[model samples]
Target: MTAAPVKNLTLADFLHLPYVEESPAWEYVDGVLQQKPMPKTRHSMLQKRLLTAVDAATEDYTALPELRCTFGGRSTVPDVAVVVWERIPVNDLGEPEDHFTLAPDWTIEILSPDQKATRVIDNILHCLKHGCRLGWMLDPDDYAVFVFQSQRETEVFRGDRLLPMLEGIDLSLTAEQIFSWLQVKRR
Candidate 1:
């Protein structure tokens, strides 16, 4: 006996299918399912801290982790997706919508060691192409960050350098302070 050949599923059918527990993380890209690498300890530490920092830093917008946002035939789970309070999609009941059918105002991706840099960058670029105002690619390996405002504009920050975030976000964060979160003191 042989397994059935995988078919290109429509978005409706894809959503209806039961999620695979082993591969909890899934993304539909160009009609194909892609499994994402599991985040390691360092990645988790950074993600958690960054999420908290960004969430509190902005009164105009809020940041969240691993939020699945769908648009343009792709469902991207950005590490952190920030949306302005007014722009958040709401249903008839005046509550947050179950499905995010639009791009985030800001998309942040923290590059896992095993993940391809280009693949991560591609998601950021995708968000930008769809009206995202800012994108941040945090590289834990080098304690550096890549800020992308536009297709042709980018800047690298490291050490004590201040990281560029969305305009109107009142947080002042430096690469060094962010990288220091990885430091753990043990007996």
Candidate 2:
């Protein structure tokens, strides 16, 4: 759903809008307010499992789910946003800051059945353009992962092929292994 604004709303206007925690996330892209589709069962499951896996595999980085990051004149909520430990913003008290004013080091987007792939890819590209090290778009139905990095051709990994990871991240995951997380009982 696109919110109809009486006039073209600027990023400043979007930043001032009331944020409701329970509502579907609203993203500001290209001066348009776009509502992300509610996550479905597969999407939710994959997001949860992937987040858990990434978190467990890295000590130098943190993976947060549904984090809203603002940069390059856009606000986006990636399925999983990974930031290097030292790069995470902290308050005066040393606690993590509530708002991110920059792109994540690594952005992950899970493909929802109703979501447009182009929009998702656009956000990833935006992050890359803003100095993000890596991005991954996971397609559950296809059991594939589309990888993006700075100055590199996009690659699709499937089955047991190892998916790319940010530098210093020792964990290795395959598209099949990721999609297997959705199965409660493995064959």
Task: Name the candidate that leads on TM-score.
Answer: 2
Q: Over the stretch 1-187, how does candidate 1's per-residue lDDT look in tens digits?
A: 1112348687666566686223436776666666677888998898899889988787899888888888877787888899988888888899998788888999988888778788788888888888998888999989898988875578888988887778878899888999899999799
Model 2 agreement with the true structure over 1-187: per-residue lDDT tens digits: 4554436788888878886234578888888778887889998999988888888888999899899898899989999999999988899999988889899999999998788899999999999999898999998878889999999999999999988888778788999889888888758
Q: Highest lDDT: which candidate? A: 2
lDDT of each: 0.81, 0.88
How close is every model to the real structure, measured as TM-score? Answer: 0.88, 0.93
**What's model 1's TM-score?**
0.88
The CA lDDT at 83 in model 2 is: 92
What's the lDDT of the predicted structure labeled candidate 1?
Answer: 0.81
Please list all clashing residue pairs in model 1, or write none if there are none: none
